[model samples]
Target: MREEYELEVLERYDVEVRSTRRIRGAFFCDTDRGTMLLKETALSGRRALLLYRALSRLEQKGNVKVDTPVFTEDGELLVSSAEGSVYMLKKWYQGRECDIRQEGELARAAKELALLHLELADSAEWSGGAKTGIGANDSTVPGGVLPVGRNPLDEIRRHNRELKKVRSFVRGRVAKNEFEYLFLDSFGKMFRIAEAVAARMENSGCMKLFSESCRRRDLVHGDYNYHNILMTKEGPAITNFEHMHVDIQAGDLYYLTRKAMEKNHWKQKTGQLIVDSYEKARRLSDAEREYLALCLAYPEKYWKTASSYYHSNKAWLPEKCVEKLKLAVRQTDEKYDFLAKTFGLIL
Candidate 1:
């Protein structure tokens, strides 16, 4: 199977494959074009090609250093595996992943992320139109103004409903494990946080602003953690756009900011620095600023822990789940502090 993939890449790109080794689901092959990484994705051929085109478009416009996929002999962007999986190959860029702890590195990453956001803010090239996972239910503003895009609060409401289900499941269990016990102990605090977040969205102009951003066709990395960033001498290169989606860029910005702050227990200083850095690249509007804080204030980690444990086989709870629940509880104050200090929230 390994040799088959390598041969396909070799014949397609016309590059000599010296050797191949597995790296993170993809095979890193030593080739004349430097180290080339070959990855098989579950995405259909059209979506895969669409993604390739988007990355190519970004690279060509000098918006960012996106590693472009190599074309096959037939001028196709993907190769097929024996089991009918799709494969993509691109140059294996040389650099270390961005370290969020290092202020300078973090700032650079934040700036690049902003630039990427700005670039994708209104990309006409991205054919993936405004995709609301659910139907676009109309939402009303204070003056009874109907926003143009989907109801943003629907997602918050949906998550809250899921949390309630998980809580109910944990309570109904015959013999609870240590993680379930921790969950039972922590559920109230988490529910309160979720309520607060929902309230913040309902009262604020968050939905209207996000609805406006929706019309902009802004793209998000979907998963924009530090690991996806490569610290090249040229600058930070964002890779792995397979998770890209069309959402209000604030979600991506919030993810990046939250991810950066989590390393330092939601330290206000670090959060401030990252937000400031991003602001320099592309300023966050009033709604986005407040919404980002609400996203942080939401007990996402706790919900994630509960959701994971609920979905898994309930023979026993893993030690890691307990540890995560504890971590979530321990960081609550710090998370609140970061939100309050950064956004001037009264909470």
Candidate 2:
């Protein structure tokens, strides 16, 4: 595969390649044109070509600063090799991933993301593809606000049953001292929260709020983590549109805050920094802020999702994993109160 890619590039560009190194299934090479990043994937040549074209369009519009691909003599953005891999080359921008702790970096990232969203919103010509981030309904109880199947409530009831089964499994494991009591206790608390939230969702009028909010769709970088943002001398440059999708602006905010909060290196203040920056740049409404608060209050959803992954593998996870879950639960309770008080939702 490497040799084939090398030959294809050699035949196309007529430039001498100096060295090649593989990083995350993509090849980084030192060539006469400077450092080039080449990605080879099993994706069809047409899809790869489409992405390259989208990147090209974004670069042309000054929305992104990226290495443009060197097209083949036949004007193809992607070339398929006989070995079943599509390959393309791009210019490598020199910069490190932004440090969440850096002064003004979080605010800068927020503003940049807002700009990207605005650029992608309602632009018919920018039909690069669908957005790719996580959605609110992804974790909702099967039969909750967003429809999952023929009956959403039935799905929630089914998940409730699974939760009960997990509780029983944890109880048995704890009795044998195979799992720590604290772990079981924490899981029990999370399960209760999930059940309560599911019930509220089923009986409350919050669905109206969610539906109204959904109408305000914008282009969101589904996964707006620090790693995907680059801190260049000019400013923060956004990259990795792999998870880019059209969704509520709140989804982007929720995922960004959640990721920052989960990081061990950053202090609690880091989460605040992101929120402050995002709020300043985007000017979220009081209602939008409350919605964000609601999302944070439901830590059980995240736990349930993680537990699914953990149980699926049945592998030993780090002690920190359990600690993080517990911390998230504690923080969720505190955040719920803080949000309620700030918004006068309880008073």
Candidate 3:
């Protein structure tokens, strides 16, 4: 659409379009309407329309502070042209994304997340929708009565076989020197550690802890990273609620802390400030906190082992790929250490 036409659309709201760009098929336009974000999609237009309607309901119910778009003369949140593209507009929010490295940003963001959760708890349902945590092995869906096609243990055995093949390939092609040998040694040890942790969890009653802890289903921002949050002069303003879902609240905490530590910000006092602030706001039970620690540990184990294998094999790969893989391995180790210290899990 031309700038004039966009302006005409905004005229209903008594606003003027200043600038526009096609972002992911949506025109994100700067307008007197306060940073209007528009989306135009062909395949997902209907889904987008549903989402817009949901957002509208939340805004009307005072459950969310979203920009409710002004409807056209026909009173539709979506406008479909003959070209099959559906258009949508929303008021753009203004603020800088909180930096995870900043001292108080994580804490403030965590508190804001807790507040959002509390607000969501007031209403039994949210308009956007809820997600089911169904994995490939989940047998609760429509054809669930069938016997298991492949046991999870069998899958694990197959994966180990594949890993052995990859290890042989790496050793034959790249392990001609002492450095390569040391890398392979570390890789093997890390894999053993991962297996040990998984085995211990399976045998130790930790699975029950995980199951019980995950039973508390509340609306949580599935991707509550620092980048999705805005640091305003007033306080932290959350954005991008599109990935919101009903899940264990600790998952959100675990994800944010993991990401923050990846940026090397989790080692400092500022990182602890964020964690403590979030804890104060949400007040997690001791059991929940312990579960979070265990949840954090599993990722570290997998990443460390995977990184060692990939980096060791990278010697035989392209130079550019090796460089990138090495950097990623370093970052993974750093994050693992940071989280381990933060949660007081040395192993």
Candidate 4:
């Protein structure tokens, strides 16, 4: 029944499906042409087409290999299933998710991300010019233009607001749990760090860099994490460009470094290695380096934990939340050392 339902959506495509197997929530189809993954998506046709065009350019550059979205027989990037769900088929590769535990793999992923960003920026330049900020009405923007991401300074301010709101909620709670207690204890220090970073960002040339990048339509992977990177025999295949957008591009590096460092217990060596690996391919600008330092310095994990606890049912808090809160607090000190030794930010 499941295969029949999925096939109904896949039938719209021109591929001859020889076999199918379920992996995670998506179906892996072995077709006569090659391998493809059929999965439901909430992406609109216009946006998917935009992504497809950007990735196709990257493929031509021959630096990054991505799972390009396939169009249907009716010339649609997405096809509707019998049950009214939308699905997209992408040219899939046989490989495992990049193992973050291995430093070598992490370095490769970071370098690949740098290469991908270079191609994205170059493609943006080739696309004629920029568009309005990200999330603007797509109708207003001209076709074939990549959208810019929200400024990190603005994002940091918004996240700080959310942190304050969570703090207020927790303080008002009469009966607090371990997670809340850990949160309250860490709030003062973490919020201080957050505010400091925000202040540093405002004073630095970060905003200028963002403005220039936006004007140039510099692109970022938007979600360049371990899950989206595939470790293939040929090289690391960067997938899932549905979140791709124009930005400072260093934001992608910061995110990749953060995820890898978190897995490695915020080791200074590992963090420095990731940065060095990226710089080997593309050296970061001073503003980008500052932005990366500020991003790493901010207690993002703590803010997320507090935010999560405040939003969840207060009657029963999860133990893992408390553990995570503790980890966030503990690792933050280690992260500061990384920042100090790495980028020479004495904070």
Top-lDDT candidate index: 4
Instruction: Residues 95-204, candidate 4: write the lDDT tens digits.
Output: 99999989999999989988887777754344544444533323223555455678778989998999999889889979877877878888899899999999988899
Quote model 4's TM-score: 0.94
Tens digits of per-residue lDDT for model 2, 147-199: 11112234455666776676676666533333345546567666676676566
Mind giving the per-residue lDDT tens digits that candidate 1 earns over 276-339?
8888989998888888878778788887887888788787667888888899888998888777
Q: Write the per-residue lDDT of candidate 3 for residues 89-136, one digit (tens) a residue.
A: 666566777898776787788777776666654322433222345333
lDDT winner between candidates 2 and 3: 2
Candidate 4 global lDDT: 0.83
Clashing pairs in 2: 67-91, 131-244, 131-245, 132-244, 132-245, 143-152, 143-153
Clashes of each: 0, 7, 2, 0
Q: Between candidates 1 and 2, name the one with more favorable lDDT.
A: 1
TM-score of each: 0.89, 0.70, 0.64, 0.94
Cα-based lDDT at residue 44, candidate 2: 44
lDDT of each: 0.75, 0.57, 0.54, 0.83
Off by over 4 Å in 3: 1-16, 21-27, 39-88, 121-123, 127-186, 196-217, 265-268, 299-341
Instruction: Give the lowest summed-lDDT range of ten residues in model 3.
Output: 143-152
Q: Candidates ranked by lDDT, best first?
A: 4, 1, 2, 3
On TM-score, who's better, 1 or 2? 1
Q: Which stretches of candidate 1 lie over 4 Å from their true place?
A: 1-10, 125-152
